[model samples]
Target: MRIRQRCGERARKRADRGPSGLSLLPWLLMGLGALSHLLGGQAPNPWIGAAGLLAFNTVYIAIVFRAFDRSRRESPLTWGLLVTLGLLTFGLAIGYGREWLLLFPLLGLGVGAVVRRGRLLPLIAFPLVVAVGAVTFWRDGWGSIGIVYGTFISIMVTAAILALDETVRELRETREELARAAVEKERLRFSRDLHDLLGHTLSVIVVKSEVVRRLAPRDLDAALAQVADIESVGRQALTEIREAVTGYREGSLATELDRARDALSTAGIEPVVRRSGPLLAPQTEALLSWVVRESATNAVRHSGASRCEIALSGSADRVRLTVTDDGRGPADGTPGSGLRGLRERVAAAGGTLDSGPAPRGGFRVTAELPVEASVPPEGDPAR
Candidate 1:
């Protein structure tokens, strides 16, 4: 929410200022000398001069006012108006020759506001420079060199400033977009982690709780041992929930196998674990551990099986894990959210996850992963 507010405030600030017709309006004062010349009525046909002055102001106003809006600035109509402004500028300068020549700089301002690309700029700028140089030199001699230089400088400077302002605004908007995406991604990760953690942990707790209930009458000491196991599971659940919330939990393959063995035994299912090949990287183990945890929990909670097998094997660059159980199989013949989440994780690590009824009348889950999985950084809390 704070991020959204900050983004709104920045957008408002960007909107409130920058390249606008009103900013260019102050430069209209530059033409006041021409206005003064006309008002004084010192030279040439007064009515024609007045008409040219009025036309220049109108076109200049039209070009500048529309230049601040992106759609209007890039329109064919704006270019046509700009061309008319150019023709009027040259007409006034060539016709009046003295005070009227000041419109060249105003034309430069309008051109700078609209023309953004360097490639296209020369197409317009070069001809204007040439025309202004030829006319100013013809009318005012070498002393008017200042007018030509000022016109070019005005175009380049204004273009650079407005272009830079546009760039800054784009960068700010891009940054806000990235920040929002990151926040959303983190929220998704947290939700998935919480689900995976609580699902497996609670299943084990419930299984052990039932074991305590059954053993309490027959053997008090055995019931107390199961109660102690429940206490240990609860403590571990608290730690895992903390890690999940903080996004810093890492899992170990050996530790998960131990938990899976205990969990399956508590649920009265025999667990058989097999492993081969070299020791794997922690990242690869962490992902494989999630597979083991999810599969074992499903076996306990849903699969009414007497035996479950978890087999892990790896080569130089790849690893595989297969968990199978002699059970009735998924009632819907499809995986639950836990398996779906596991598929997303494995796929992100450049791996594959498959779950279905095995050919031999039981449920099976097979996961194949690269030896060094491309997992985002999060590891076992103990590590």
Candidate 2:
């Protein structure tokens, strides 16, 4: 499965590079023209005319293939080569038949595909080539009207090929730009997850280390127990980190509350948790859990507070969670990276998040999510 996916991606990347097989289109059209000429009527010297037509086709094919190549296109040498081919084909047609004149306009079309410096050259040159063919047919007085109509038809065909080539070029550019944007978005998500995971875990470990330092001299047994708890927390943090790397980790409000209480206790701060109203959906519960964990981590790591409070409440239409601590708030009112990411997450869930200093003291983070907001629809992955 993985191999197939990789192969499919490689194919798509190749397609996104540019249009393929463009050089063959001109030859295909020329082949049809040759078949039509052969079946139209008898010729004075069919073998000689066929040899001359084959030689013209060889030159036309080379010019067209080179015109489509981005590296050599639009060079002074390339346009000069096209002009030479056009004159040669026109001279050959004068001796062979009016049919050979049709090949001349193709040279103009190929040059127009590249060398945008002379944008009007093909429009001007094609009509002149058509007039020359029409005049030649007039001199012979055989199917004169048909010659005029065929000239215009050839011009239309050339115009369609040029337009298609341009559209393909634009599509390739847009595809590459979209791929770049997707990669940048994934990088941002991974960085945000790593910061949140490691930040909270490391903060808890620091607080527990402080507890061990204080208890070791007074109560060796108690300090040993704290060390054991620290070791356990470290192992759990490692497991969570691994899960986070694979994007399979899920947060729970209940689990965050338990860990927050333990972290507060280790930091010598009291924890008070309260929940009310109906239960929340799993997604909402997970979102709130992250908010609580981040808020609690900030309270323990930054704010020198003695108490922290966590509250969860739900109404018929909305669920709200708030984390508050009795500690000095942000000196400049600017939120940290975790809170910024939390705001984005909550908004994606059709929710709102607010954070600032409490009216009394310290910092407060609040989140409210719509209870009735339906899960993301089928084919619409979660944000």
Candidate whose TM-score is highest: 1
* Clashes per model (N, Cα, C within 3 A): 3, 0
What C-alpha lDDT do the candidate models reach, one value each? 0.86, 0.71
State in Å the error of residue 26, model 1. Answer: 1.2
Candidate 2's C-alpha runs over 4 A off are 1-100, 103-162, 372-383
Candidate 1 — which residues are off by over 4 angstroms?
1-18, 377-383
Q: Report the lDDT of model 1 for residue 206.
A: 92
Q: Which residue pairs clash in candidate 1?
A: 249-379, 250-379, 250-380
